[model samples]
Target: MRWEFGSILPPEVKYNLCEPEILWFNKYSKCLANYMKSIGDNHGLNLTQDSKPPKSLYIEVRCLVDYGKFELDDGESILLKKNSQHLLPRAQCEPLIRQGILQHITQ
Candidate 1:
C-alpha cells in the first residue's frame, strides 16, 4: 500500500511475494524471447537454435532476512535471504542469442 498510482515504484517491500504474479512474467518471458530473437535476426544476429529447457528464477528464502519476491520450490522451500537474487539466467538465452539462433516461440 506504500506505492501510489503511476508512480515510479521502487523494489517491492521486504517479504513481498511475487510468485502470484509470476504467470505474467512467464508469458512476458516467452514473448520477450521471441521479440529479442526476431530483432536479432532482423539485424542478422539471431539465428541459433537452442533446444535447452528454459530456466526458472525464484528467491531463496533462507538467504533473505528482509523481504523477498520469489520462493524457490526446490524440494523444501526456504525463506527469502536478505542477499537473495531473483533473476536466474536463461541458460540458452545468451549462447543462442550470441550464436544468432532463431526459433518460432510457442505458447
Candidate 2:
C-alpha cells in the first residue's frame, strides 16, 4: 500500500487523510471520493475538474527568503531558495512570481 511517486492520495494514506477542519486547515478529502463529491456538491464547491491553469511555467527564485516548502507533482518536497529554478503550475506559483520572489524563465 505504499504510495507511488507523484501520488497525492496513496492507498495506505487514503484512509488516514481526513482531519477536523478547525484543527487542521479547512481543506479536506474523504476516503470515498463519491462521498466527498456529494459533500462538495451540497456545499457548492466542485471537486472534479482541472483546478490548475492549463499551462505551466518555469521560474527561478530571486530573493533570499524561504518561500516555504512545496510538494511537487513529482513527489518531491522543495525548500525554495534563492537562485533555485523550478517548473511549477502557473496557478500554484502565481503569487510568488507576482511578488518578485521568483522570476519567470522562458523555456
Candidate 3:
C-alpha cells in the first residue's frame, strides 16, 4: 500500500476503514519499508525494478556523470567518467542505469 498509495492513505479511503484496519495498514507499511531497506545493502537494491530476466548478459552503456570507480562482483573495478562508454554486465549496471547515472545504449 505504501508503494501504491503512499505513506498516508487518502482521506476519502481512510474513512472507509475501521480503526484497527487503519492501524494495521500503517504498521504493515512501516514493516514492509524497513524489510526492504534491510535487504537492499549498500547499493540500495530496489526489488521492484528490473523484475524481468535479461535477454543478454552484457549491455552497452554510456556514463551520464563522473561516477568514479565501480567494482564488479568478481572484484574488477572500472572507472566511470562522463560520456564514457562501456560494455558491462547487465545485472551489475542495472541499478546505475535506473539512477540515471548511466544510459543504456541499444543498437
Candidate 4:
C-alpha cells in the first residue's frame, strides 16, 4: 500500500474506531501508502504512530474494497457486496486537517 494523493482522513473522525487510524483496502494501493509516508514525514509518527502527533503520524487504513459498509465496533455491520466502490468523504477525514489531540488547529 502506497498512499499518494487522495483525501487524508482526519484524526477526530478516526479517533473512535477500533483501528482508528488509516483505513486501507487492497494491500497494494499506492495512493494511501504514499500519502501515509508523506504524512509520516510531516508528523514524525508513522502510520503506526502513537501517543502524540509526530512531525508525521502513521495510521491504519481499511481497504476501500472492504470498507464503507462494514460493521464498525460501535456494534453495526454494513455490506456493499464485492464490486461496490466508495471513498471516505473529505468532511469525514477532518482530523488530519486540524492540529490537535491536545494542540488544536493553529489557524
Candidate 5:
C-alpha cells in the first residue's frame, strides 16, 4: 500500500479500513519513514524508490567497522576489517550495508 499510494493512503482505501487497521498503518508508515531517514551516515535512503532488482550480482563495499568472520552462503568465510574494501555479493552484504557496518561504493 505504501509503495503504491505513498505514506498517506487514499481516502477510498482509508475509509474502508477499521480504526485499528488505520492506526496500525499509520504506525507502520512512521516506522518505515524513520528507518529510511536513518540510512547512510544520516544522509538517508529511499528504499521504496527504484524498487527493482540490482543491475549487477555484486557490489563494491567498504567496511565501516571490524565485523569479523562473515560467512557466505557457499560456506566460505571472510574477515571484515575496518577501513578495508571488498567486492561482496549484494544479497549477503545488504544487511551489513543497511546496518552501517559496510558502505556501498557506487560508481
Candidate 6:
C-alpha cells in the first residue's frame, strides 16, 4: 500500500542475543562430527580410527594485517582490517594467528 521509492531506506538495526559462545561451538561440533561420519561411511575409510573427534573452539582475535575476505556465520564475506578485533572460530583463524597475521586476544 506504500510505494515510496524516493524515500531513503531505514538504517539496519542489530541486537544482542546474549547467547554463549560455547553453545554455538557445541552445535557446530556436532554438525562437523555428523558430516565426518557420513563421509567416512560413504568411503569405508574408518576416519575415526586415526583421527581425533571434531572440536569447536571460539577465540577472540585481532587482525594484525588486512585479510582480503572472510566469510561470516551468515555466509556473507567481509574484509578483515588491520587491528580489528573479532570473535571467530579458532579453526578458521589459527593458521593466520600462527603466521603472525592475527593475534589471539585474551579477555
Q: Give candidates' CA RMSD values in order.
A: 18.8, 14.2, 3.8, 18.7, 9.6, 18.9
TM-score for candidate 4, residues paired by index: 0.19
- My TM-score estimates for the predictions, one after another, are 0.24, 0.36, 0.58, 0.19, 0.59, 0.44
Question: After superposition, which runs of candidate 1 have C-alpha atoms over 4 Å from their true positions?
Answer: 1-20, 42-107
Please give, for residues 3-91, the per-residue lDDT of candidate 3 as tens digits: 66767899998999999999999998788767767783454544545557678989999999999999998799999999999999887
Clashing pairs in 2: none
Answer with 1 or 3, whichever has the higher TM-score: 3
lDDT of 2 by residue, 64-87 (tens): 466778776558787787777776
lDDT of 1 at 62: 23
How much lDDT does each candidate structure score?
0.38, 0.52, 0.84, 0.37, 0.88, 0.61
Better of 2 and 5 by TM-score: 5
Q: What are the clash counts of all predictions, listed in order?
A: 20, 0, 0, 40, 0, 0
**Tens-digit lDDT track of model 5 for 42-92:** 757678865896899799999999899999877999999999999888867
Measured by lDDT, the strongest candidate is 5
Scored by Cα lDDT, where does model 2 land?
Answer: 0.52
Tens-digit lDDT track of model 1 for 56-99: 43211122245334333234443344554333224323432244
Q: Is candidate 3 or candidate 6 better by lDDT?
A: 3
Q: Which ten residues in a row have the lowest lDDT in candidate 4?
A: 98-107
Ten contiguous residues with the weakest lDDT in model 1: 1-10
Q: How much is 96 displaced in model 2, in angstroms? A: 0.6
